[model samples]
Target: MIHLQFRKVHGNEGESEAPKRSAAARKSIGLKAKAERFASRNGSRSPGKSPKGRVPKRTARLESDRTSVASAIAGTRSTAPPRPRSKHFANAVRAYEAAIKLMHAEDFGRAIRSFEDLIAEHSEEPEIQERAKVLIHACEKKLHENER
Candidate 1:
């Protein structure tokens, strides 16, 4: 046989089927209530407000910002895209990338040869030529070390 204890929900108090909480939990809840009360008395707003139906202040500012930015961009629109540094830069870049790929695949001899070809053919693009020269040295060093 089992027995149960029932507490009455007195005058203005409508109780539900929730279990009793511990002292620490109740104390923390009371502190939160006090914080809300203090925040209300001051000019500060309480946190975790419902955003339903009310347009936030930032929405207005952001809309204005969007219109202004759209107008400014329209005022400064251009017809043609920007040009590259040089005409042969694309070919040089392609060759350099292929050489680097060969070096990564451990074909250092072939990589060295490819980089040398890039350096010879793309002398107008000095930056790519310089990088190819550097990679050539690296490939040579790696190749000789592996041969030993």
Candidate 2:
């Protein structure tokens, strides 16, 4: 002989399903744990705090180093001499004046040649070189128009 009996169980007769977490939530949780471990290893009281709540003695040394650096800079500044005026300035000015005079006299060929020589000789004077180049272009244009 066999007997059958029914017993009451939880209303939902299924495996308990945990609430699902998104990928971003999982990554955030992992990052939080890693940060906590890193802080503890470094003797920090909290994630955003300095270790042991004490200022390191290096602050004093840093102050001394800063003063030494400042003095060294000042010493170098005192020892260095001021720059002298360029020796080529007078010559460059003279050549530039001559080129301008030739241009005004309508001697385009000579003016262009003088400007070109100035550019070749005093490349260090960029302002003069640029002016000479523009004048040379103007002289060439005039010469071309005269030809036509």
Candidate 3:
């Protein structure tokens, strides 16, 4: 049974019943609840293990790599790897150096294009991708400054 409360308006001329929600209208909410349920049901995290308050493996690896790169550039050589890196890695290094050369040459427009291309082509190298993104932003800033 639904109880409707009536309120009298000015001059006692109008009476309005309170709004009531139907049964079917109660469950519809935002997409966040649905997404949480879907992610939990999927393998986003192990069923037995809690993902809260934990850094993901991929993020940890990227952080370590960034630190190693900073150390290497700061004149402290990184430790030797277990094996030689692949040719693709070597090619990416060369390409990144070329883009840096363009930046040094003050060719911000071309450097931005080069960095964008590197990002698109070298999806496997997150470090390079991140560096390229930073460079692209820098280049865009310089280009905008020069235009002003």
Instruction: Name the candidate, 1 or 3, with the larger lDDT value.
Output: 1
- Give TM-scores for every candidate, taking all chains together and pairing residue i with residue i: 0.47, 0.43, 0.44
List model 2 lDDT by residue over 1-148, tens digit each. Answer: 0111111343433324444579999799889889889877986766456556575568889999999999989877755565565879779989999999999999999999999999999988888999899999999999999999
- Model 1: clashing residue pairs? none
Model 2 residue 84 lDDT score: 67
Q: In terms of lDDT, which candidate is stronger, 2 or 3?
A: 2
User: Lowest-scoring 10 consecutive residues by lDDT in candidate 2?
Assistant: 1-10
Model 2 C-alpha RMSD to native: 11.8
Off by over 4 Å in 3: 1-84
Writing each residue's lDDT as its tens digit, candidate 1 over 1-148 gives: 0112233434223335555679999899889989989888895766677556786569888999999999999989876866656657877888899999999999999999999999889878877888888989999999889989
* Stretches of candidate 2 exceeding 4 Å from the true structure: 1-84
Models, CA RMSD each? 8.7, 11.8, 18.7
Per lDDT, the best of the predicted structures is 2
Better of 2 and 3 by TM-score: 3
Model 3 gets an lDDT of 0.78
